[model samples]
Target: MSDTRLKISLASDRGMIDAALVVLGTVAEHCSAPLELHFLGHGLRDEDRDRLAHACDAHGCALVLHALQDEDFGDAVQVNENIPLVAMARLLLPRRVSGRVLYLDCDMLVQGDVAELFELMPQGAALGAVRDFYVLDQMRPGSERPEKLAWHSKVLGRSEVEGYFNSGLLLLDCDVIRSDRALMTRMTDFAAANDYRYMDQDYLNVLFDGRVFYLPQAWNSIWGRDRLRAKTLAELTWLPDAERTPATSKVIHYTGPNKPWKSQSKLLALLRGRLPALMKWRRAASGRYA
Candidate 1:
């Protein structure tokens, strides 16, 4: 069982450590499977690492820390100059870790048994993820929206329905990544060729192309820019009717700029009654250890 325990990977910087702590605390509260957490970042201070290790220890989970510097990736990493180097950490997971691992963004909270997600992965799917709503909108341009460029298509020169998946939460088959150097090379090449609108996410969609297994939205409920456009999973036609409500969601992702931590942000206020779970995240972010 120890060998098969779920492995979770999180990448964080100074600004996101609090959010990461909140995620860790939430997992402590609801996740029932034996687990291991891997933290990747360029500036995880010794004290912070100690604190994180202690928190996981209290939860009876194991923690592994990788203090990486920007130079480690050479120039293969792609992100805005303003984005933290840690933003590229997910790209390194294939080479840095072993076995199947789930990559989760720090700006999310676990609300149910995470092992359920792990168990739901279908065999031969290199990765499993929920559809990114904003990307879906771009892919399915409508009345007011212009069609996406042909380059964004799976066929490259031709337009095809190549859905995009968010990288924020991924059930990765690390063995596949380790064995497929061509996949890694192609992703790096793609990153170097053009500036992606969504950083590594764009590269991931391009690299995987049609290989991704789209999980139910309930697994990774995302918060988009215009709440009116995607206030709930029900609003997205891409989502299955069965997984529509917040009550059924296993995770809530603060995907856009308006984070729950920004107590004063008007965007957070828009969440209104939908943010009771955020209160739990906030408590965890404060280092309360749930």
Candidate 2:
């Protein structure tokens, strides 16, 4: 029983397998603590799983791959046009992993010691996450899409002042999560009945609602949002601070469709002035260790 061990969970569709590898490689490089990585994915080819096992072995981390079933999540696994069905696998993490688990989306690249986050648990909070600035952006007046923003309050059963949290990075107390069957049932039921713009994120906001412990923006800094700091400040609460730039950010969430896994030139264009940070993610995502 090593005190420094961190349990991590990741869920990916077949298409995002490479993205998963890059994330693991980056964590292997930067994370100072030991790790136990559990991956929940559907129909992963043997070779890819073998490769992931080898990657984890090289990093001195243990890896487990669980075959995912749609039925396992009930109606909660319903399709979302915005995200792959597998992305919802995070919903099952507490039931599957058994103890405290850190759930990270495959699209993210970590640069700091993840152990720091793994050790933190807010008093009496079921989940710890960063606030979703996109929620605030959409909720603001004068935004073109009123319908999307309108649901935040309706779905969460609270006002926007309570804040909506990003599901990309979560530090979950699995014991607490497993104890609450009603919360899980409600989230699944909500997912089945409603079509949400942000997919499982909406359900999580509704599930955790006011209970989420908000972590700092540096912990789950969104790539595009952090870069947009030069443009305006009012709507971007998720932006990383000047001192906690990409180099210092513990987690850089490559949110949205334009990812660093794209070709170098394309990434350069997409990231524009933020290429230096993009270069780091690109290198990690590509598995170019040299």
Candidate 3:
């Protein structure tokens, strides 16, 4: 029997409609379970609602929308320029829904059945997620920066290097999250008052700490891994060869500001978009020629 329980949640605002369309459209195309998307949008227009609903309906799925605003986050200071205020909306999503939910970022595309991740999830974690590239990069002695690691540890208020997980793709155990209201409150408060480089992402990592189920890197494969400074994939000795690209990744996350949807700009934009692709090729060719 087809699993009827998979529910995916995501957040975005009006400004990110184009990327939202791409992500939602792909989810509709690839999901194996009954499609139910719970979305949080701040200042969304009626026209945009129709567009999102259509993105789901195009593949015969349904979307339940929850309109959001800054006040929804209470005293939290919203000040990130690279992402919309709605990006923090996921912090409150567990209370809004029941059962397990897979929260996805709008900058990604689903290429396989994600329910497999739930099967892979271990017992007792409030959530499951892949470790961020920063965590992986930290494992490399040459790339390690004691000062930067210290900054992260200070920000997290915990020194667990493995605790960091990319918030882009989350498999949440809503019941567990709802039960931990005190931690949630403290995390939100800290995120509001402090300077966390990754914003709400850092807030979650700190609060969850050892409670997270470390997911396979394939489930949240980053398309443009900016942290990888190596000239070739082989030089990524810290990473398994299977993980260098989407060899088995079910979702391709286009992380950072330079999205495929955004039109090109100058130096910064150009480097974020093209350099990763070039490095992948150079790494492969160098191995072949050598």
Candidate 4:
């Protein structure tokens, strides 16, 4: 048992199969830790499973499938949404007494050693998330609506909430997560009751308010229009480069409808140029060493 090696998992429906594969390929290339990929939800068809298995074999990583039982949440309802799938996946993952498990969304791509995130784990927190940039109390001129504001307030659990987090990436202490079913139940209940503004993110903010450790924005950078308008790729400090490569990024979350796989993102194009070669080298290295 290697203490430094971490177990990582992703939750996704069938629509994210390609994204998940891309994410896995990226992780296998960049991370030096032992990796585990779990597929949750109904969309994981047989063909998808076979493709995932082939990818895992190519990288010498373990891939497992744990179908969510209706009994797990006491509901026969199937959750195809990313937010709820994320929450349910964390709650149902197999427990490990000592090692850490990092839960990443399918939309993310890794650029560095994710094992480093385990070392930065806070003492009492069961999970960690990066703050979302769009969580503002005062809505933009055209975006403001009383109902929307009220929904955001309820989702955040308060109107004056600080630093709303993006729930696409999470680092969980397996020991704490396995034992904290009560908190998981509470989160589920909150999601069921609230017409959440941001789905799972809203539930997480309301449940783990002020408890989750705030990591650097680089960990889950949103590559949307606003970020591009605020700063160009040259000005973006988090991008890996000759002089300023990130020392502590565990994952790179591509949150929102826009993703690197799509043709619209300039940032994705830049990353795609670099990530594939790295992935190929890692695959060869793993074959030789593992």
Candidate 5:
């Protein structure tokens, strides 16, 4: 079997860092691969680095810190949030490493072993993305007709455009990413031109389009108000002592404003209760492995 690694990018911002640590810890426990937590952007304090190192130690994961100086990229504009951070990581892909790297947003949690995701990489595509559930009808101005949002489905050529895919979770083929300069340039250019809603995600859809393999919805299952109304609470809740089942998804992405951390929704509260315990498990597992 090919070696696999779990990769993520984050800044030193406290909230995002804390969230990243929690998710990283969760991923470490669930995945057997070497975990590579790549820290990008600025303000990463020594103490923060130490804390991350300690956490990685406990989990037996290999942690790599890539301090990206401003000079690394020529004069590209930068967004401090998840979008640009993700784009930066993508730009640095296929690093001197072998096999594929799983890039996950800091806001996600791994519910089960994601080693299987590495097996899903398409031979010709640079990466795989999940269609964004939120873009179904909100792509255009509210006053404009709903049909405008459907433009992708109507006018977009299968080769140039397809349904919008969320950029939060991705499985990138390092060889394809490193060899295809045009693909990287196009991703960068698209982000520069259309710096609007969805950020990197919108640009990614425009760049890769039908070229990307659409992974099953379960892989990037997201939670939001719409999901709450659509599925029963029992369906989304993660129970303690529950064995890890062979589910379709390798990760669960909390894509929108309503995260399990700050949500007051009834369903969110129930899921929130399990987070502390998961964190505890991560810490313990990290210590044993480190």
Candidate 6:
């Protein structure tokens, strides 16, 4: 028998708990399959956990929370102030969860039936993700930041940097990730040993590299400042000649420092305009979109 329930995972701290719920709720509204939800973090208020559990229960899904202490990580890796230790909690998930898990950052917004992602598999790969728009732009000819291109190339450890993927949305093969603990450990070690800029992103991209199945941009439609030339998965040269990104993006991942809740921002309008499904879901959530 095939167990097809979608297992979704997320990690965050007390600070982002509210926002994570909003993301999770929105995902649930749009996703049709039975869900197995997991949240890993510390400092969450009881209400937060209760709210999450209730929501999942209402939808008939199991929600698991792993509460941790600061010492739990125990200096596993060093992080800049911008990214807290909780960012590394994802690496610990292989031991904590089983099967293929879709690990999403709390900052994302879902606009499609995410269950559709399961139709694709990691194959021989450890995970799946979308190529970063910013990284690809940086590697282009006469790019504004040649140093970034050089650094990304160095981090990737080969002349080819096109395969580099964004870690914001990962379709992780936990079986593979669990089996490759030694290699995954090296990812954390590299972050601790160097001035790694992108936190977990650097860890995954550098570690998984060629081992990732680059999913469609629609699954992780990057909402960046650059207005990346390729919006849909089919537009990207790497994808097959089909509607991968789709006319309407499946997910819209807001990248960079300026997040929606940071302040009154124009992105809210973009969200309202581009994704009718999200707008309806957001209306029911009632102003959490801010």
Residue pairs in candidate 4 whose N, alpha carbon or C atoms collide under 3 angstroms: none
Per residue, candidate 1 scores C-alpha lDDT tens digits across 4-74 of 66899889877787778778777767887788888886676887787788888888888888888766556
Candidate 1 TM-score to native: 0.82
lDDT of 1 at 91: 77
For residue 261, model 1's alpha carbon misses the true position, in angstroms, by: 2.0
lDDT of 2 by residue, 1-290 (tens): 45457888888867888888777777778787788888997778888788778888888988878888767655554455547778778877776777777888887888777777755565557898877756555544355355666677777765544368889999998788778888756644535534666677877876786677777657777675564432333444444453233333678887766677665575565546556567767766554521
User: Candidate 2: deviation at residue 255, Å?
Assistant: 1.7
Candidate 2 backbone collisions, by pair: none
CA deviation > 4 Å runs, candidate 5: 1-14, 71-89, 94-98, 136-145, 148-162, 189-194, 224-250, 263-290
Alpha carbon lDDT of residue 52, candidate 3? 75
Q: Write the per-residue lDDT of candidate 4 for residues 1-290, one digit (tens) a residue.
A: 34444677777667766767777787778887677766565446788788778888898787667655445554423344434443445545434224467777776667677766666667767777765645432343344445645765666667754446777777766566556677755644633533454545566676677677766555665443223423333453442242122433335555544444544544554564434433433343353322
Superposition TM-score, candidate 4 onto the true structure: 0.69
Query: Residue-wise lDDT of candidate 3 within 185-256, one digit each (tens)?
Result: 664463463357677887777777778887767677777553453333345565544345544556778776
Error of 6 at 52 (Å): 1.6
Task: List candidate 4 stretches off by more than 4 Å.
Answer: 1-4, 69-88, 94-99, 136-151, 178-181, 190-194, 224-251, 262-290
Q: Against the hidden true structure, what lDDT does model 1 obtain? A: 0.69
Q: Write the per-residue lDDT of candidate 6 for residues 1-290, one digit (tens) a residue.
A: 12767899888888887667777876887898878887887777888787778777766777878887777665555556656667777766777888888888887778777787767763556788878767666655544465667867777787677777877788877787768768756644634533567666776777786787777667776654314535322244454543244645677775555555554445664654433433443454575432
Q: What overall lDDT goes with each candidate model?
A: 0.69, 0.71, 0.69, 0.58, 0.56, 0.69
Where in model 6 is the C-alpha error above 4 Å?
76-78, 140-145, 187-195, 224-227, 231-244, 265-290
| Best model number under lDDT | 2
Give the clashing pairs for model 1.
none
Error of 6 at 241 (Å): 3.9
Candidate 6 lDDT (Cα, whole model)? 0.69
How far is 258's C-alpha from truth in model 6 (Å)? 1.9
User: Local error of candidate 4 at 265, Å?
Assistant: 9.1
